[model samples]
Target: MPSGPNSGRVSRSSGRWRWSDATRETTDTPTAATLETERMKDRYGLEVSTSSAEARDAYVEGIDRMLSAEAGVEDCLAAAIAADPGFALPHAALARQHQLYVRPDEARASAEAAVELSHSATARERQHVEIVRLLVAGQVPQALDLIRQHVIDYPRDAFALAPACGVFGAIGFSGRIGREAELLEFLEPLATHYGDDWWFATVHAFALIETGRWDRGRQLAERALEQRPSTPHGAHTLVHALFEAGDDDEAVSFLEGWLPDSDRASVLHCHIWWHYALVLMAVSRHDDAWQAFRHNCLPGTTTSPPITVFSDSSSFMWRSELAGQPRDRAIWQQVREFYEERFPQPIVFVDAHAGLTYAVLGETEQLQACLTELQELGEAGRLPAGTTGATLGQAYGAFVDEKWSTVIDVLEPLIPQVVRIGGSRAQRDLMTNTLLAAYVRSGRTDEARAFCAQVVDRRPTRPVAGFELC
Candidate 1:
């Protein structure tokens, strides 16, 4: 057996290849073994220590599978645990899965198990465990603070950095006014540590584009794809940069080529389709946009959680309505049915979207029920006081009742704080559009025109088809 860059021991004979079992020893010490996969390494270049070499291989495989949004991630994690019961990192990874599934109880249990087993794990593994525990416990501020320090202490920890810089990451969802600025600044120092690395370059490009540095962002994102053409994160960043730069032709061409090969099980797959639909709409391809929406980004079309599915579906319907594209009202009813069955609670952002659906569909009963839920949540301190759910619901109810003045009164005060709902600026613009439409419907054309000019001045790239200055 021969050993080299990877932890595995390789052998060659008669044009055949095999990994030698010599890498494994029946020893009590946690040690690197031959079970490491060929050409696999963590961001830090260390082989994960485990009693069973197969467990180490399984853990590494699971992490890679997760990055590509492949299926069998849980099966891989379970294999790791079955191979080595005390492996803490795999348990922490499982907690992330539970978190995304919106099963907080399961997430908490898995995260606690990781913490309990961390006493014998490496320092890096222990830190990862802490991160999972804090996130699952709903201690977001503490989790974010720890992530910042963890990256500084272990700059090569992609596990920590990915979640910190991701589109739905802690900082991305933090609701800070200058979030893009903060992200770009934070990433600059880490460049020296992760020079030209594919994933880091992709995330940095996203931050750059979000901060309006489109030229540099485009260059970096394209470079990341050149190195790894199938990198979904790179493709996602490039799409955003292209859209923001007003290169609609290139954006459409790139996404059309990219989406077919994207893993359907991956969370980003539907989101990339959402971007594709927006590009189609930008070019007056409304029918094509609706086709994309119905076939891919719609709620029942994908396996994404109700929260994510609702966000994309509601935004797509509203955008189509803005373009004067005719849609069956039955789609609205189907969406409302799904929302009622899946999400009975007012989960801040989900509530905002559900309220939009109910108002657009004229489901007065559901709209009133949403308001009732928000009021109950607010009083119990489950949701923040003055949450967007509460305000957006009020605005929607008023819009339905033709009390447009009351809609403006409820929404205008909260527009600045709407970022608290934890979506991208593009997504939050749904609320702004709703408010502007309310102004138009109420015959406050003068105020609506002023608002349109202000918004167009602020976001020149945003489509302003419906808010025409008539």
Candidate 2:
């Protein structure tokens, strides 16, 4: 057995290529030898440290389903643990699932279990478990360092590499300027290791689209969807690329066709519907957009994580109002209540949207309280997104008070740092649209047209109804 960092060994046995840990000893009996040769591997061809085939198979199914945002991921992962109580990877995966659903305590518990069980596993599995443990414990810097090293050693370990990949991933939320370019740089080198893989293509496409390489992103996204049509991530990435290219017609058509077959209980379901609503708003289908929001994106209706529910619902309503829809104070109050219930603390992304809700609803007390918290977090250097959200929140408050110049003064200088708040460029358009509306309403027509031209240089369309300057 080889004893080094590259400890995964491939050997031809029984007319098949099989992967095995280099540390595993060869068995004498033919049946035992064959069983060892045929040990269960995951969909990514990484060997899982589980003796039970049922456990291994269930773990693989659960991971695939989780990556694609399908329903039944938790049940599948739970079944894997039920089949083999000591399978470390399933526990690690369950921790990730719990984190995705915003169940932090359960995530930490499962992460601890994974770490405990991984002591007897391979070095790769042990590292995987440890990274997940760090992530669930909110030790993101350590987890990211470990993930970088782990991927270099075992690039096919997709789950281990997942924490740093997407917009909400560690890098996206790193509060670093130019993080979009950083994400593309991080993923581009790994392309060879993940050729034609649906998950890789989807995330890579997203990074590309976010960085303004929409044409290349669209090609990859299309291929990813063709490779796995059921993958909601692929579909979501494709729409983002389309949205960036200003192809609202095709974007809406594709989503309307694809959404019917998707599971509403899935992770990206509400978000995907939010994307649909955005495109509908772009095309002047305001009635349809409102219907879509009411059905899928409303607080009571959405089954998304708390962050998604709050950000998506609040942003959609605010954008609708900007598009000349009458303000529905009742709906804004419902969104405000949901935000208060789900997130009392100031997560930079959620707080950014919470500001809009509070401003629109005239909740001056709540708004001031949130602003104070954000200011303190920023002053202490505790805010991962720095003061971007706080500044934007203040801008929203100014906009609500009809202080257009104040909104311009606060928001224009902060535009460069807005990416730190961690959402898709499309999602952050809530802020951009706000600034544009401020410029227009303040009779700063020249500045509005210049800003609109800059936006058009990046994207082909500006969909805000009343603030169209081009």
Candidate 3:
């Protein structure tokens, strides 16, 4: 068996077997003791800290479920913690889940507990817990630095590497230029370490899709789903690749078949349904799109994380109006209430969508307040996305007022930097659609045609209403 900090050797002494961390030289070892020790390894072949088999099993289950966006992650992690309260990794994993679901206080406490417990853990496990600790504590830059180093040392530490992967990951929200490309570059080198691993394939596929390698991404996503059909992350990544490839019909068909088997309580369920609604809109199934939104993507209806609920609800509502559906103040109001209840501070991606909600509701006071905060954060260098959110907020306000020229002026320059705001390109299409609308409404027909032509070259379909006139 491969040996590392996590590896252990099993020995029989005094008519009993015990596991120890002492390194043993390989000599074509195929002893019964060696075989028994190998069974103690994790799914990725790393030896875990816990001696309890039940704790290790539960921890592995929780980590796999979390990576796949499956239901019962909390239950599994809690079971692991209950089985072995001193296990540091499960505490760190639970903290990540709490953070994702917007339970900041719980996240912090769990993270701190993990850090405290990690003093007795392996070096790899200690580093892993510390990375989660930094992330939950909002020390993202330091966390990212540690993540990069940790992955280099422990490439199979999937949970530790996860925060730096995908569109909403640390690199995705790094506010750095060419972050999409950066993510691809970061993941490409790690592929050899995780060949055909479902979770790795899903995340890597998302990175590929984001960087415009849709065909390859789609292939990888399909392979991932085949490996683990229950993975909502795999399904969601496939939806993104299909959306980018302009395969609306196929995307809708795939979702219809896949979603029935997915648990609605899963973390990515609402987001996956949001993708379904998007494809329905692209195919001009406006009524179906609205139904999908009201049932799955709405703030009140969705069981997703608060950030997912806020962003999906607000983005879908705004895009529905852009697609010629009448604006519903009631729906926007629900989203606003959810945002207020869940997010008391600015999260760049959620704040960007909240800007749309405020502007459309004619809540200038609230919109300006958000813009002011973003501007202040940007000025102080406190915002990772810097001025991107503020700029988009301005564009949303101008968009609502029908100041097409101002919308164009503000958004055109901001387009290149929009990736810093943190979301998949498809989500950011809310901005692109807004700019396209402005171009068409402002009678800049040539510019609209030119801009839209660029879009069609990439997407091959334009779902926005009035786009045909352009």
Candidate 4:
């Protein structure tokens, strides 16, 4: 909520004045004056208009690092801000980084600074700051509206395109019906402007996969990876393309090959490993999958946002549980500890995952605490997806209590709208799987069989054994 700024503090990156208008007199800063002699344009052919060449170079490199899942993006962004404190785009970029890192307070501060400073920025920089501000505020629908115009105006603004076109992007995560179609429609037209751009290739490939263009998506992902071997977004798209194409073996091999050097701080770091774990689960390699979870996905292993950590860890455990894999109580204990440390309050998706751990571990008090809060939030109409979450929290409690009928009653009607809570089809399947399992467990054989068939038809390539009622 920090907007239309007045000299606020931006959370420091490395004990430095991370956000300040350092010597903006132009004449006073001799070094900036000297460095400003040469000007360079951005990828969109828009002049960066920074006082320091080093800052411009660092900003571009930082963007690449972030897109590629490499380290040093923070350092580079910090350097850019230090060199040119009034650079609105870098401030905007820093805002995005802060949001990704789950420091919303810092993100808003940076975004506000970007907005205020953007008055003097070029049209491109202003656009960048505005879009980023919308993103930081979780206004995806509005951000998409702006991005639609942005693309028409500056189709080559690949940096702006990155967040808009990602698999976990505003469009993908918007929970709108026909999101796949939306992604395809939004990205397909702009493909010409971003020819061979590695980030663009990855995003377009993901859109293709979502829209059922699996072969083309895979080919594009592969080409992108070839261009930038460390491109995590490309790797992510390829994983999805392979999954959709029913090629689990290649998916496993590809992820394993990349796991060795996956940057711990990169956005895709934990998520790629999550994909690897899912592929292993698909192959029924439970032990290896658990190994991956322990090594790559345990709480402290990577710097993925809380949302990623919550989904990946909870889904792994829930999937394993559904598969009848023996529970590692120690890891569950670790997961519980991690959850407690990170989430004292639960959003809908995070709440359900927290309920999973609490139920499995018989932590009744913890589960009730989350449920109580969720119910309160739901009734107040402040929750994103309405009262379904509160109902699910109750369902989870009933599920733990072995009250299968209660679980079915709560979730059956809500199943159609499950995507509203946000998460991809694959991720939301945890809820569907739970309902199916509950039906079978409750001895409702006919209903269980019918639901199982429906699920199989929807995800025909999934391992048949996982969907079986018996």
Separately for all candidates shown, the number of backbone clashes (residues 3 or more apart, or on different chains) is 0, 0, 0, 0
Candidate 1, clashing residue pairs?
none
Please state the error at residue 311 of candidate 2 in Å: 0.3
What ranges in model 2 sit over 4 Å off? 1-31, 455-457
Provide the lDDT at 400 for model 2.
90
Best-performing candidate as measured by TM-score = 2
Q: What is the TM-score (0 to 1) of candidate 4?
A: 0.83
Tens-place lDDT per residue, model 2, 379-445, is 7888888777778889999999999999999988888789998888999889888888888789887
Candidate 4, which ten residues in sequence have the lowest lDDT sum? 1-10
Q: Model 1, 1-470: lDDT tens per residue? A: 11222223222234222233323422222334534333223424553546665665667556655654455678778977988888888899899888877888889889989999998777877887898888888777688898898887787676666667854677766656566678888888887776666666778888887776877988988987886676667787888788766788889999888788877776666777888888898877878888888887777798765677778887888766655566578887777787877775666567667777788888778677777878777667676333557677777667657787898888887887776666665677677766777777677767867875664313324354455655
Over the full model, what C-alpha lDDT does candidate 3 score relative to the true structure? 0.83
Question: What is the lDDT, from 0 to 100, of the residue 273 in candidate 4?
Answer: 88
Q: How accurate is candidate 2 locally (lDDT)?
A: 0.82
Question: After superposing candidate 3, which stretches have Cα over 4 Å from the reference?
Answer: 1-39, 455-457
Of 2 and 4, the candidate ranking higher by lDDT: 2
Q: After superposition, how far is residue 2 of candidate 3 from its true place, in Å?
A: 18
Write down the TM-score of every candidate: 0.82, 0.92, 0.91, 0.83
Sort the predicted structures by lDDT, highest score first: 3, 2, 4, 1
